[model samples]
Target: MERFKIRVIVTDQDVEKVALDVRPQTVEELKEIVRRHCNLQYEFNMMYEDPDFGNALCNLNNMDEVPAAATVKVVPLITSVSPEVTSNSSDISISSADTVILPSSSRTQGWPEVFSIPNFSVDVEFRLRQANLAYLKDNKTFKCPWDIKRNILQVLSEEIYKFDTYPDENRLHEVARALIGKHPCLTEAGCTDGCSGWKNSLYYKMGNFRTKLRKAGCAEVSINSSKNTPGVSKGLKRPKRCEVNFLPELPEREETLEAVRFLLAEEMKKKNPNATTVASKMDQTFSLRRREIVDVETPVETLKERWPALFTERQVFSEFNRIAATNLNDFFEALDRYTPKFVSIFKTKGGGVGETLTEFLQQIDLRKQDVTALRTLVLRGLPVLLGDDPSDFYKTCSVTDDDGVWAQVSIGLLTVVDEDAPVGPNVIHLEPVSTAIIIEGSVIMDDLKSLPEALCILFGLSYALHLDYPKSMKNTLNFIQKVMLGLGHNKLPPKLQSLKNVLLS
Candidate 1:
């Protein structure tokens, strides 16, 4: 038995931070300290499940008696061992070396855990960041609803700066070094930051923060992607300048996330014993152009350059100005559902997969409410996917192959859900054209936005799969309708708010 110092913080009567030493026999005890000490402010999220220093805690706030909802339902999505249940699973044991000792910084003034819904990515990193987000959402706000927004912003600020939860590049490299025998270097491939695309992240070594972490960092020969670990210089290889595959018959529904989630979910669970249903539920929460704030410590004024429309929109998108605006979540979902799943694999012309992915990440921009709506859509899609006949409802990333010899397509998607409404969910969708499709024809280019969702889905596949971005842009507009006819709004209004005010809001 080993003696360890444990501090569980909660808002007891006043803002109180509790510290105690725990002699834990098994891994389960780490969780118990969190549950009991946390009391009303409970956060037992496992960022890095090291069997070592008890489990890491989520950011907790406030103190209160157990509310009725807490006892009424224990929405158990992820599995856990019951302290009272005597069984094999409950016999918790942890390794001494892996325990997460509260760092000196964490003990004095605990830092938060921040996450981002990155353009390219990894699952573990995403989940690690999300654990704090889960706390932000679940934790209670101040009694006066007036304090809600301020409280959220405060939490957001703290969490976004929470970088310690997930590993940086050096950390990931260390893990890779353990497996590969040396720090792998990039040689031939053009580097784009890792675009694990959907469920991955770009990380750097804490030590390497001074250099261009996104570029190739190799002391010797370059490491091929199959052998390299994630978040490192994600390899991007360019295939010969190829024509877009001419296969017109591939069904669009084949590439949607609904089609892919289950297969991926099974694989993900093997790696994460605890990331069962809870993680899946969190995945359901993101939508087109969703931005989970990582490093929230950065103030809003700094983000204003990129997110100018937010403060300005309550300033820019009005019936006064003719600026066009559509439901962000809906528009992105539309694109995700109908867009062709394209890949610009490392074989693209002199480019590597990393660069291809970084390009994808750079294109995305979104409004806040739009993301919340995506969660609703994904959650709704989950049940259907787990059930039968879910193909028609797929996300439309990629489906029909181009009869084997056709050129590949590229895909980009945005799903935005407006969270302001108390009644039901709302979303908007968006997609941007890659440069490859420009060569297709003048006719397609003339009416780009009029294209249908399915064709746009097809067009998006041209990027990473190494089709041409310009070539597909023209082809993509084949179906986008300018006027959302059924929504009681014109295609492009003389004034943007005139359209938004009528239906979109």
Candidate 2:
């Protein structure tokens, strides 16, 4: 028996040169030799570079057939038991380490434990089966046909849409890696991991798929379509700060659009409406409302006339629940929980803004103030901290001149009063007085107790009516959407991330 050296790669940074006395007769024998040499105690799958496919790593099924001096990669299986793991004979365990964690800031958050690829069409499956059989018979590299690849992508795109309508770059790569892992024969020749090409193809396929979905009246994709978002040259309107049920499908069978609309209208007419019934009707009519708001781009006045209940405080919170899937109470509780930290962070700054924040903080006795007052203070100070001009977001004008100011304002917190309360310059102190949320120069929600409530309702209405974040308060709202409410994309902007890091620290 002649001795030869085979390079074993345990990880990207870990490689070992193993001396084999003789060619292993089976894959188990090869694993035993690798375990002895590398001192690996855990069960791991092996993939050896195949000269037949320009040295791309292929699953090492038969050690007897493996080429001499092959480079073998050892992939460790996840020790934690999960239902998502596929126990199929052909399935290889994808290491947790292999998954690319998005947004380096959030290290704990990564890809799902299992990336499930749905079955292809019958015809496509038949073709793939034949190709896979050929590859198994004589080590033939399966050249994926265009039609077969298209069908595979179609199925995968559908699966991706089930999670997110707009999957990021890392997500697309994860899907491609999962595809090649399940179907090793589809590994691209000359590629390092064998799925770079697949990733690129998937990116384009997703774009094409979204285009098709947009044309087919998919409200989620349609809202971000080019035609809907004119003048948005840089980026389309998408869920940046949260995973909103932007445009959910209409309720099936029992709850038709007309039926739900009628039910909702009847409930709205009640002097003291049933909260539970109103909430259910609002949820049922989510798709209908989304269509009018997103597709039709209905005016605020018209929307109020059609869906009057939507403007009510109860319905505003209900709409938020439908879109964000979070309770209004929970939002306030979270705001209250983080108020002290935010206040501390704000106090650390020393500048004009800091000085202003100091004055704002001094006006409110932290010990004496209720949760609502603290939350209001924090919300007001947030825009200032984030360097966002609060003039547009939180507007203050006398009751006499309110009509002119409301007309000019697009969306914000509007405070109309008989007399100017002397709190401080540029400071709108939180009072138990009536305030309103102005959208498109119209008061959609009114008779709010404080700024925080108005802000929460305004944030919810932003989603309900598909309105963009106000330019002046973009950062502040984004922070609220991403950090406070915990809705939106994983990757926070640098400014927000920095603030988050400080807050977390």
Candidate 3:
């Protein structure tokens, strides 16, 4: 097996933690596949280097040692020669500047078991250009495999302005999680094992609001009034749906509902010529309206109340209170300091919640015939939202099947049993988006495999269009990030079963 180096860039932009090294091996003949497996052109590129690090070919027998995963320490090299030339070549030697070593304590323990392909050789040939760096410059390295306040400062900006440097462990974990690719929880004794290195009441240990992040998945409840409900003298009425009052509406896959509203209104007018007068009467009845935006400022008193959640003693809060003098600006600053904590608490997916809904319905026995109808009714209005299927992959079903598009979708099935609250008629369900696309289904799924059945259920659910569509272009960028984590460095497809041990270990 031939070993090739790989570099994954973990940026500081709104991320928790990321790693830099991986080892992968491939055949010299079908080398192009390597690019597909890990490259920026696809969803896996966000975590990759523009000038990727890997060999061109894999030697035989040594196949087991393929460079499936490695963490990288990205250091910027400024040389006398142009930076471009240095990257253009396969390798370049640089004069030593300051060296930052990972102190071995930084690695977390116990992550999940992931998979990746085996090692291979490289057949690359390139000339090396000179690389240079000035000794006067400062260098930074992260996750130095160490646990120390000093080292933490090393990774952050040196020109220290007074601010709360400590977020919580959960927040820190999440920040690390976002910044790094598939990380382990931190410890004084670092455990590099992805899934089973260490265990504790991590969620409970990190208590209070300071400990929780948005990713822990907040509970949401929506209150809405409907006109079709029973009235004092009226007979039984048709049920109306309750809507969610959302802030900065949840994101869409590709198309906007606003674009189609005009046409729909026109159709309604055509169907009822006297509709204007009827509409006036209809308006007098209950109508839909946008949720009112609340501009109430987050209070300092609220922060003071929440501040104690981060620590045992009020010392840290007291120190900040001393500086900010109990003012709103100080509270806002405190909130910013604690922002990192907010992320870590949520990113950890919180329990087996993904399985909770399914577990509740595990005993259900849906006959083949019933599932077919349920799927049909459930996906009725989602054609533009769920997306169309390509020959192979779904290829972003939420976007318009129009020419160029990118679509991202998150789907789940919710069960219904109560007669009083039977699943009603909305084929696909979605919340408004501030970012990201989320889709929900209410069908029993013992067999979502048969091509005909899958199509029947999923085809029309594409109502909102794919994420690849133009309106959702910004959110689609995240697809690249998630895909990278799902398949890049140490992440291999199911075929590479033999290499699974090392990936999660």
Best by TM-score: 2
Report the lDDT tens digits of candidate 3 across residue range 26-138. Answer: 33321233333332111111222222335332223333443344333222322223334322222321221111211111111112222111111111111000000111132
Q: Between which residue pairs do clashes occur in model 2? A: 241-487, 241-488, 242-487, 242-488, 243-488
The positional error of residue 283 in candidate 3, measured at the CA in angstroms, is 23
lDDT of each: 0.26, 0.71, 0.24
Show model 3 residue runs off by greater than 4 Å: 1-263, 268-505
lDDT of 2 by residue, 183-261 (tens): 7678788789889998888787776566556645555776666544434546455554344465565445434776878
lDDT by residue (1-505, candidate 1, tens digit) is 3334443333212232334444445434545655565442212342221223343332222122211111111111122222242122112221111111111111111111113211111332233345435445663211212222122222222222222222334433333232112101211122343112111112322212211111222111111323344456544321112111111111223245434434443443454433344334223321100121111222333333222222221221220111112222344465344222211121131334344333333333324434433333332322222222222221221122121211121222222112332221121223312111121211112122312332333233221122333322321221222322112212333433342243333
Query: What's the TM-score of every candidate structure?
Result: 0.17, 0.65, 0.17
In model 1, the worst 10-residue window by lDDT is 241-250
lDDT of 3 at 125: 12
Q: How many clashes does the backbone of model 3 have?
A: 93
TM-score-sorted candidate list, best first: 2, 1, 3
TM-score, cand. 1: 0.17
